[model samples]
Each structure stands twice: as structure tokens, then as C-alpha cells.
Target: MRILVILRRVLDPAGIVAHRRLRRLFINREEYLIQPGDHSALEAALRIKDLGGAEVVVVSGQPEPDDDTVCRGLAMGADGAIYLSGEGFAGADDGVAARLLQAVVDRLGGADLVLVGMTTLDTAQAQLGPRLAGALGWPQIVGAWSVEIVDGRVRAVRRDGDDYVVVETDLPAVVTVPGRALEPRYPDGARLVNVYRGEGGMGEAVLRWDVADLLHPEGLVPLLENRGRDFPPERELGVRVEGTTEEVAQAVAEALRARLRGA
Candidate 1:
């Protein structure tokens, strides 16, 4: 079986500070990590590869530097990695990304399965997987908690109200996993060193493809545009109720009622 996993990079929120008073975000350290949702998706792909002996190919979900996320995927037991980059790919939105990925699927001669994160950490946009599924004309299971392949179909567990329900789809389908649903294994020390240093016949496993080659001029247009950022109003100090017990209780109840009504 041929399985494709999509990966993305995100800035570490701990390394940044948001100043509401100043209405600005400051980056103390510019460190990047794999998107948490995509990390879980990678773990799912690795588990499938381990059980069924499938070829796991990791691909970048957006245009980025090849050295970070791609190398990490290699060290995490992916059979191959592909970095998609080009001038045309810059600032491409979810719609353009999905179209470009569909072209990649065609260039790779199709795949048996595709896995991606249900939502992005930074933007919280969940359109990529669904859009890609529509472009490929394949079935999709979104917000999956767990996934497995049985017989000739893909079985996934997802939340429905308070219960977890099993959903099934045919082969050549897309599955989007929720963040932190599965714990990702640590990368192998030797493999990590080799992949970073480009040694042990593994250097050729990571390939770079240009977005211009995969997409047309019309397909490169982004659907979303960036408006200016908005900041919430600053917080105010809490009011203190000073009186006898009955009076304080009455004030508290009235405050609660007012807050609920406002809500």
C-alpha cells in the first residue's frame, strides 16, 4: 500500500509573547515545531506502515524550508519525503494548496490513502483536507480520533455527540485526524543524525518539487485575503462587594444574572 501524510510547521507559542495593552505580538525566539494535529496524523501513518508494511511518503502541506519538517518526517520512519516550494506558492491559501496537492497526487500516479490534520494550529482552518478530497473526487473522514485499514476499506472512529462512532470509506480516500489524538514516537537517534547530515544513502529520499510545475497560473490564485488584525478590549478590575452576608449574596446573584443576560 502507498500512504501519503501531510506535515506542516508552526511557531512555538511559548517562545512568543502577546501584549494586549500594546496590541502587538513579539517573538522572543523564532523556533518552529511540527503542527500538533499533523504530528498525530504522521503517527497514524507510521502505525499503518508498521502493521501492513506500506510505503509511507511524507509531503509538506505548505511551502517551507525543507530542512526542518521534511527531515523530521524522515527520522520518524517515513520511507520518503517531498518538499514543495516555489515563488508561485508564496502566500497561497488553503484552496490553492489543495489544488496543488491534487496535482501532486496525479504526478505520483495516485495513492492508496492520504492523511492530514483536521485543523491547523495557527489559523484553525480545516478546509485543506476536504478541499483536496473534493478535488480528487474521493471519500473523506474528518475529525477522526483513530484510524485503521480493514479488508479493502478504511475504518475510523469519530465523536458523534457523546459517543464514538465508526465510519468506513473505500480505498483511495482521505482521513483528517484531530490534534493530540495519538502520541507520536520519538525519532531514532541514528536515523535523525543521518537524515540531517544527508548520509547512509538516505540523502536521495528527500526530493524537492517546484509548485509552478505542479500547478497552473489560474490555480495559483489564493481564495483568502489577509485583513488587518483586531484586538479585544482590555480587561477591567474586578468589583468588590462589601456588606453583610445577605446583601453580598444579593449583589452576587444580580451580577451573575446580568452577566448571563449579556452573554
Candidate 2:
């Protein structure tokens, strides 16, 4: 079985500060980490590979020259990794990414299962998995808490309202794991060292493909546009009301009613 996992890099939230009043974001330190949700997806893929006979492959979720994300996956026990790079792909949007990933799957001769993050941390956009599924015309199970393969099908648990529900899909399906659903194991020390230093065939396992080879000019055009940023109104100081218990309660009710009316 061939399992494909998509990985993305995100700026660590702890290294940045959001200035709401200034409507500007400040970065004290620029540090990148694997997207949390995607990390869980990788863990799910590794677990499946450990139990059943499967080859795990990692692919870049975006266009980046750096292969850090894929190399990290290799250290975590992935069989192979593919890096999608080139100038044309620099600012590609989700639609373009989905199309590119579909092409990669085809180039890989298809896969038995595909895994991706339910959402990205910075953008909080849960569109990649569904978009890729749509592009491939495959069944998708999103926001999975846990996943396993049984009877030639992929079984996953997802939260439905207040309870967890089991959902199953046939093989060759897409699954998006939720963030922090499963703890990701630490990478092997030797493998981690080799992958980062490009030694011991680890560097050879990570293949790079030019975006131009997979997409045309029309396909490279982004479907979304950034128009600028918007900031919320500044917070105001609280008002004080003095009176007995009943009087205070009545004052609060009246204040709420007035605010509602104004809204």
C-alpha cells in the first residue's frame, strides 16, 4: 500500500505579536515549524505504516525551496519525500495547490490513502484537503480524531455534535486529521542528524520537482486575492454602576437592553 501525506510549514505563533491597535503584526523571531494539524496527520500515517505493510510518502503542501519539512518527515520514518518548488509556485493559492497535488499523485501512480491537515494554523483555512479530494474525485473524511485501516477501508473517528462518531471510507480515500488529536513521536536521533546533514542516502530520498513541469501558466494563477488588512475597533473602558443588589441587577438588564437595541 502507498500512503501519501501532505506537510506544510508555519511560523511559530509564540514568536510573533499581533498589534491590534496598530493593525500590524510584528515578528520578534522568525521560526518555522510543521503545521500542528499536519503533524498529527504524519503521525497517523506513520502508525499505519508500522502496523500494516505500506510505503509512506511525504509531499510539500506549498511551494518552497527548503526541504526541511519533508526531511523532518523522513526522520520520523517516512519512506520518501517530494519537494515541489520553483518561482512560479511561490504565491500559489489553495486551488493551485490542490491541482498540483493531484498531478503529483498521478505522477506517483496514485496512492491507497491520502492524509492532510484539517486546517492551517496561520490561515485557519480548511480548504486544501477537500479541494484535493474534489480534484481527485475521491471520498474524504475531514477532522478525524483517529484513523485506522480495516477490511480494505479507512475508518476514522470524528466529533459529531457532543459525541464521537465512527466514519468509514473505501481505500484510495482522503483523510484530514485534526490538530493535536494524536501525539507525534520524536524523530530518531541518527536519522534526524543524517536527514539534516544530507547524509546516508537521506538526502537522495527527498526528490525535488519543478512547478512548471506540473502546472501551466493558467493553472498557476491564484484564485484568491489579498486586499489588505482590517482592524477591529479599540476596546473602551468599563462603566461602573452603584446601587443595591436588585437595583444593580435592574441597571445591568437595562444596560444590556440598550446595547442590544443599539446593535
Candidate 3:
């Protein structure tokens, strides 16, 4: 089974605060700590490989030297990685990224399973996985913690609060994993050296279809919800006490009554 994961280079908090006033949410130029969501997705894919999946591939947004997520993805355990770059791809919303990723998948011969994080930290738009599934026309299940690739079929365990589920799907499907899937593993030191030592890295590097023109904001039209809501209202509390067990209840009621009267 071939698996694909989309990784993003996130801005460090200090970098964000430094330029937040400019309204630039990201500074992709600097080194990045892998987004936990991205790590979770990769971790799940690794587990699938460890359990016998044929291959694991990572797809990242950009290939700049500072893009730690893509480089580390190979170090961590992915068999290969693909990077996409183009003018109109900048500032792509979740749906747009999903669209772009679908294009990448088509060129990569599609995947047996696609893994994505539950939600992107910067955007908090937990919609990418489903959107990608929509674009790829695959059946998808969200928040999976464990996945098994069996004879070209997928059996995944998804958590719904305290309970969990086991679902089955054919190959060429999409799946979004939550942190519950598995913990990240230490870099495969020896394998890392061996893989990078080869020329042009693992797997073929393909540019895929460029969808910038089709994905421009205006081309899709718009119906954005109002952003930046006010914080929820605060609640105040008061305490009361009274005498004997039975009479105490009455006394507490009287005290509450008096307090309400005072108010």
C-alpha cells in the first residue's frame, strides 16, 4: 500500500508574535517544529508500514532548506517525500490545499491510503481530511488511532470519545488520524543515513498538476463565516452555609433568598 501525508512548515510562536501585528500568520522562512498533527499522521503511517504496508510517501507544501517538516519526515520513517511549489498556492485555504494535494496524488499514481491530521494548528480548520477525501473521491473515516493494510484492504480503528470503532475500506482511500493513533518514534538513524546517502533521495520527484489558476480565491467565489469572535462570557459564583443538617438546608435557602433580595 502506498500512503501519502501532507506536511506544513509552521511558524514558531516567537516568530508569530514578532510579526502578528502585520497580520502575517506564518513565517515559513525560519526553522519549524513539526506540527503535532503532522507528526501524528506520520506516526500512523509509520505504524502501518511497520505492520506491513508496502510503502509510505510524504508530500509537503514547499522544499526550502528551512522546511524542517519535510526533511525530518524522511528521517522519521517515510519511504519518500514530494514537495509542491507554485505562485497562486500561497495562502491556500484548507479546501485549496486539499485540491492541490489531490493533484499531487494523481501524478504519484494515487495512494492506497492518505493520512492527514485531525486539525491544522494554525488554521484549526478540521476540514482538510474530509475535503481531500471529497476531491479524491475516496471513502474516508476520521480520527483513526490504528490502521491495518490487509491484502489491499484497509481496516482502521477510530476513536469516538471512550468508545472505538473498526472500519473497513478498499484501497485508494483517505484517512485522517488524531494524536491517539500512535506516538512519534525516534529517527531511524541508520536507515536515515542509508536513504539520504542515495542520489536524488527516495522515490521520484514529480511536480504534479499545477492548480494555482483554478484555486485562486476569486475563482472559487466566497462565503466566509465571520472570524475573530469575542471570548465567552464570564460567570460569577457565590457560596452559602448554615446550621444543622435539616435546618441547614432551610437556612441556606433563606440566605440565598436574602442574597437575591440584596441583588
The lDDT of each candidate is 0.89, 0.91, 0.70
What's each prediction's TM-score?
A: 0.92, 0.90, 0.70
lDDT of 2 at 40: 95
Candidate 2 ranges beyond 4 A from true positions: 61-64, 241-263
Shift of residue 195 alpha carbon in model 2, Å: 0.5
Q: Encode model 1's per-residue lDDT on 1-263: one tens digit a residue.
A: 98899988889989987778899889999998898888899999999888878899999845655478988998999999988988778788889988988998999999989999999998899998999999999999998888899997899999999999999999999999998789999999999999999998679998789888988888899988898777776788988899999999999999999999999
Per-candidate clash tally:
0, 0, 0
Which 10 residues in a row give candidate 3 its minimum summed lDDT? Answer: 201-210
Lowest lDDT 10-mer window, candidate 2?
60-69
User: How far is 170's C-alpha from truth in model 3 (Å)?
Assistant: 1.8
lDDT of 2 by residue, 1-263 (tens): 99999998999999997777888889999988999999999999999988987899999845555777888899999999999888778778889999999999999889999999999999999999999999999999999999999999999999899999999999899999988899988999999999999899988998888888898878989999888877676677888899999999999999999999999
Winner on TM-score (1 vs 2): 1
Pairs clashing within candidate 1: none
* lDDT (Cα, tens digit) per residue for candidate 3, span 182-229: 788988777566545543444243223345533555533333434752
Q: For model 2, what is the C-alpha lDDT against the true structure? A: 0.91
